[model samples]
Every structure is written in structure tokens, then in C-alpha cells.
Target: MALLEIENLAVEFQTSTGPFRAVDGVSLKVDAGEVLAIVGESGSGKSVSMLAAMGLLPWTAKVTADKMVFDGRNLLGMSASERRKIIGKDMSMIFQEPIASLNPCFTVGFQIEEVLRIHLGLDKAARRKRAIELFEAVGIPNPAERLGHYPHQMSGGQCQRVMIAIAIACNPKLLIADEPTTALDVTIQKQILDLLMRLQTEHRMGLIMITHNMGVVAETADRVIVQYKGRKMEEADVLSLFESPKSDYTRALLAALPENATGDRLPTIGEIFKGAAQ
Candidate 1:
């Protein structure tokens, strides 16, 4: 069975100008042990859609869907209390900015231990032990010693590793990573992505990878959904999508890949489309 399912989902925000639909008529599914990649430029609603699904969107955002189910339950109709219980236990998200997401006032150990306390109901000692294990699992060096360090003390990569530790603390069935490698150097980005993939396969979790980086998608995803302007441009298996993209937008993105850039000036999407039009 699909771990997550959404149909005709729409999300609108009450902006100053008017109601702006950030996500429009989107539909997709994620199955157990599968890596589903949502690729789009910023403000394309890839992150917003998943946030809405997790009931994390603010009150200003109006979310609706014809159908939304997770683990065979109706997420569209579930109560907030029920949703809260499932969010940390059954599903968890690793947000975009790692350091920004952590509470500056607390130690990394405390922040991650909170997840174990709340969801797993682990005792203080147990929480500490589990947090150390999670830290090590995420490749954080000196896992036991570093847990006491505050967000400011850790590097971007370390902060992200802490975030991953918290996200997987409960061994959730679904893991959503929203630009998990955003500000890291190229070397760290690969390490972070590799760690996430390892955890996902090890736990047999359904993974949703949201990013604008086609390179990450190409290396990790089993299936890919290309989005533009809050709508799906195309959906296909990773190999097929890269080998022969159907939509012009998808084709343009593939064309503008760093590997495909040969000349001094990288080709812009508009330029590619304009040439096609000509």
C-alpha cells in the first residue's frame, strides 16, 4: 500500500494582495521504502504541500484536498490532536535550515531528546542513551560529547546531522527532508544525502526528498515529479525523466544542469524556451 496519498490538493494563502494559491491541483503517492523526489524552484510549493500534509502550515494558509491519506488513514479529516501524535511518531520532517530550526537556547542533546520523550515516552536516561545512538547513527563525531553543544557551537553540517537524528528518533515510517543540504559545501551535501539514504533503506521508510537540485534527485530518487508554478510539469521514473523528459520545463531544467553547462554563460530556461519558440 502507498504510505502516503494525495489527490487534487490545493493550498492558498491569505496574502495582502489577495488569496494566492501556492499549490494547485496536485496529486501523488509515496510507497514504503521508496524515495520520491519533488523537484521545483523556490516558491513552487514543493515544501508547502508537504508541510500542509503534516499539518504544519500556519492558520493563514488554507489547505484542502479531495483526498489525503497516510498509512490508510484519512489525513484530510484527522483531528489536530491525533495528527500531532502521528507527526512525531509515524512521520517526521528535517527542515531546510538546520541551525535555524534548532532552538538556540537548548543543547542539541536536549532538542533531540525532546522528540524521544514526547513520542517514544522514553525516560530521561533512556532519552539520553537513544539520543547518543541517534547522534552516532547520523555520523556526528564524538556523539556523546557533542550532544551538549548548542546550535551556535556546531557547524552547518553538524547541525543538520543533529536535525536528522531528531527526525529519525522515533524511527518514523515516513521521512520528509526539505532541502536538507541547503547551505553546506559540496562535500558535506553528498555526505548528508548519503546518510539520509542509508537511514531510509535501513529503516525501510518512505522518503520524500524536496529540493530544486536535480543532481540530488538524479542520484537518490526512485521516482521524480517536476513542478513549476505550483503545478506538476511531469512525473516519471528517474531514469526516464533524465533520459527523455516530456515537458519543456523539465527539459529546460535538465539542459541547464551543471554537468551540461559547457560554455562560459550557463543557458537560462527562458533562453532555451525562446530558442525552441524560434
Candidate 2:
């Protein structure tokens, strides 16, 4: 069975003007030890869809799905408490903004320990030990010392690593990384991607990578899902998707990549779509 599955997922926010749908009829599946990349431009509902699956969307957001299952459990039918029991223990997410997502008042170690305490019922000593191990596993230097540091004290890359450490602390069966390397330098980006891939391989976890960077998709994804304006545009294995994108939107996205540039200026998706319409 697939580690995660979704069918006909949709999310809408109650805006001042009216209901605004952010995700519409999107469906996807991820198998254990597989890397599935969801790629799209900003506002394409890439993050919203995953957030809905995780039940992280706010009260104003109305999420609906025909089927949402994780590890054979029906997520849509689970109570909030039941979902909580599984969310951090069996499934985890490395959010888009690591520094902002972390609590400013507490030490980073304390935050990580909280998850362990709540999910795994680990005692203080065990939590600390596991936290250190996780930090080490993610390649953080001076893991024990860094535990007491606040999020602000660390660099962006280090903060991201801490987030990764927390996400994998429970040895989750699935991991959702939403723009895991966003705003980092290219070197750090590569390092983070490598670390995530290694950990995913080691744990044999199903990984869903939400990113707009085509390079990231190429480097990490076994399969790709393309989204545009709240709808799925295409889905294919990574190799086939790159070599022969069936959707014009997918072709436009690939053409926008720097390495694929063929002119003085890269053509925008709008321009490409407009040309196709003509």
C-alpha cells in the first residue's frame, strides 16, 4: 500500500470578498522509500495541499477530500486527538521557514524535546539523548552545545538543520519537506538536499518535497506532480516528466530553468502560455 494517499483534495479560505479556493481536486500518492516532488509557481496551491493533508490549515480554511489515507488509516475520519497522535510520530513536516516556525523564547533543544515528550512519551534524559543524535545525524556540529542555543543564534542553514533534526526525531514513516532549502545559499541548499536524501534512504521513509526549483526536483524526485492555479497539471516519473512533459505548463516550467534558457531573456510562463493559446 502507498505510505500516503489523497484523492480529490480541495481547500478554500473564507476571504473578505468570498470563498477563495487554494487547492482543487488534487490527488497524489507516495510509496515508502520514494521521493515525490510537488512543483509549481507561487500561489499554485503546492503548500496548501500538503498543509491540508497534515491538518495544519487554520480555522478559516475549509478542507475537503474524497479520500485521505496515511499508512492505511483514513485521515479524514480521524479526530483531532487521533490525528495528533500520528502526525508527529508517524508523519512529520519540515516547514518552509525554519527560523520563523521555531519558538523564539525557548531553546531549540527544548522545542525538539517537547515533540519527543508528547509523541513518544520519552523521559527528559532520553529526549535529550535522542535530540543530540538527531542533530548529529543531520550534520550539525557541536550537537550537544547547540541544543541550548536559540533559533536566532544559529545561521539559516543551521536552523534548517535543526528543523530537519526535529522532523526526523521520531523516525517517522513519512516526511514532508516544504521548500526545505529556500533562501539558503546554493552550497547550503545542496548540502541540505543531500542530507535529506540520505536520511530518507536510511529510514526508508516516503518523502514529499514541495518546491518550485526544477533543479531540486531533478536532484531528489523519483516522481513529479505539476500544479497550476489550484489544479494538477501533470504527473509523471521524474525522468519521463523532464524528457517529455505532456502539459504545456510543465513544458513552460522546464523552459524557465536557467540551464534551459535559449534566449537573452528567459520567457515567463505567461508568455509561453499566451504563445500556445495563439
Candidate 3:
């Protein structure tokens, strides 16, 4: 059975201009120990689809998902209290902006420990010890000292590592990372990906990496799900998707990427969206 299954998922937001379907009908599966990449532009519904699955969408948003299952249990049918227990234990999410997602007031260690305490029922001492271990495992140097520091005290890369630590704290069966490396420099991004890949292998967890970076997808994904304008464009194995892209939108995205990325002509992503860029 798949570790995570999302079938016929759709999400709409009731805004001032009537309802907008942020996520059109979409279906996807992530098997055990698999890395699935959801690639698309900012408004392509890649994030919204998964957010709906996790029951994290705003109250104003309406979501309908058929058989949104995690480990064989339907997520959509569960109560909010029941879902809360599963979120940080059986499932976890790493947000797009680690800096913004992480709390400024709490120490990094406390934040991680909070998840452990709530989900795993660990005592203060045990949670503290486990939180420190998680920090070290994610390659944060001087984890002991770093643990006491607040989010604002760390570099972007360090902050991301802390976020990773929190996500992996309970060794969840599935990990959904939404644009995880979006704000980091290339080197730091690579390191973070490496760490995530390593943990996925070690834990045999299903990983969902949602990002616009095809380069990252090429490096990590086993399967690929391409989204465009709140709809699924195509789904294929990583190599097949890269080698013979069936959709024009996927091909256009590939074409827009820098061949050499020379001079000032870094490619603009706006071209792939079809609508006029401001």
C-alpha cells in the first residue's frame, strides 16, 4: 500500500471575487521510501493540494479530497483532534520559509521538544535530549549551544536545519517539504537536500518535495508530479519526466532554465505562467 495517497483533491478559496479553485482535481501517491516531487509555478496549486490533504488550509478555504489516505486511514474523515495527533507523529510538514515558519520567541530546542512532548509523550528531560540529538543529526554544529538560541539568532541555513530537526523529530512515516530550500544560497540548499535525502533513506520514509527547482527534483525525486494553473500537467518517473516531457508547459519550463546562466540574463519564471508579468 502507498504511504500517502491523494485522490481527486480540490481546494477553493472564497475571496472578494467569488470562489477561486486554488487546487483543481489532483491525484498522487507516494510509496514507502519514495521521493515524489511536485513541480510548478507559484500559483500552480502544488502547495495548496498538499495543504488540503494535511487539513491545514484556512477556514475560508473549502476542500474536497476523495480517499486522502495516510497509512491506509482517510485523512479527510478524521476529526481535527485526531488529525492533530497524526500530523507531528505519523506525518510532518516542513514549510517553504523556515525563518517565517519558526517562532521568534522560542528557543529552537523548545520548539522541537514541544512536538516530541505532544506526539511522543516524552518528558522534559527526554525531549530535551532527543531535540539535541535531532539538531546534531541534521548537521547543526554545536547543537548544545544552538539549541538555546532563538530562531532570529541563527543564519538562514541554520534556521532551515532547525526546521528540519523539528519535522523529523518523531521520525514520521511521511514528510512533506514545501519549497524547503527556496530562500537559501545554492550551497546551503544542496546541503539541506543532502541531509533530507539521507534521513529519508535511513528512516525509509516517504518524502514529498514541493518546489520549482527542477535541478533539485533531478537530484532527489523518484517520481514527478507536474502542476500548472491549479491542474496536473503530467506524472512520471524522474528520468522519464526529464528525458521525454509530454506536456508543453513542462517543456517550456525546461527551456526557460539557464543553459549556462551567463551574464545578466537569468531566466524569468513569469514567462511560464502565460499571464502578463507586472
Taking every candidate in turn, the Cα RMSD to the unseen true structure, in Å, is 1.2, 0.8, 2.9
Candidate 3: pairs in clash:
none
- Using lDDT as the measure, the top candidate is 2
Candidate 1 structure, TM-score to reference: 0.97
Per-residue lDDT tens digits for candidate 1, residues 159-232, read 99999999999999999999999999999999999999999999999999999999899899999998888998
The digit string of per-residue lDDT tens for model 2 on 144-251 reads: 999999999999999999999999989999999999999999999999999999999999999999999998999999999999999999999999999999999998
Clashing pairs in 1: none
lDDT (tens digit, per residue) of candidate 3 on 1-278: 99899888889999898999988889999999999999997889998888888889888899987778899998888999999989978899999888899989898888999999888899999988898899889999998899899999999999989988999999999999999898799899889999999999999999999999999999999999999889999999999998998887887677678873545866555554453322
TM-scores, each model vs. reference: 0.97, 0.98, 0.94
Question: Candidate 3 regions off by >4 Å?
Answer: 260-278
Prediction 3 global C-alpha lDDT? 0.89
Best by TM-score: 2
> Candidate 1 — worst ten consecutive residues by lDDT sum?
269-278
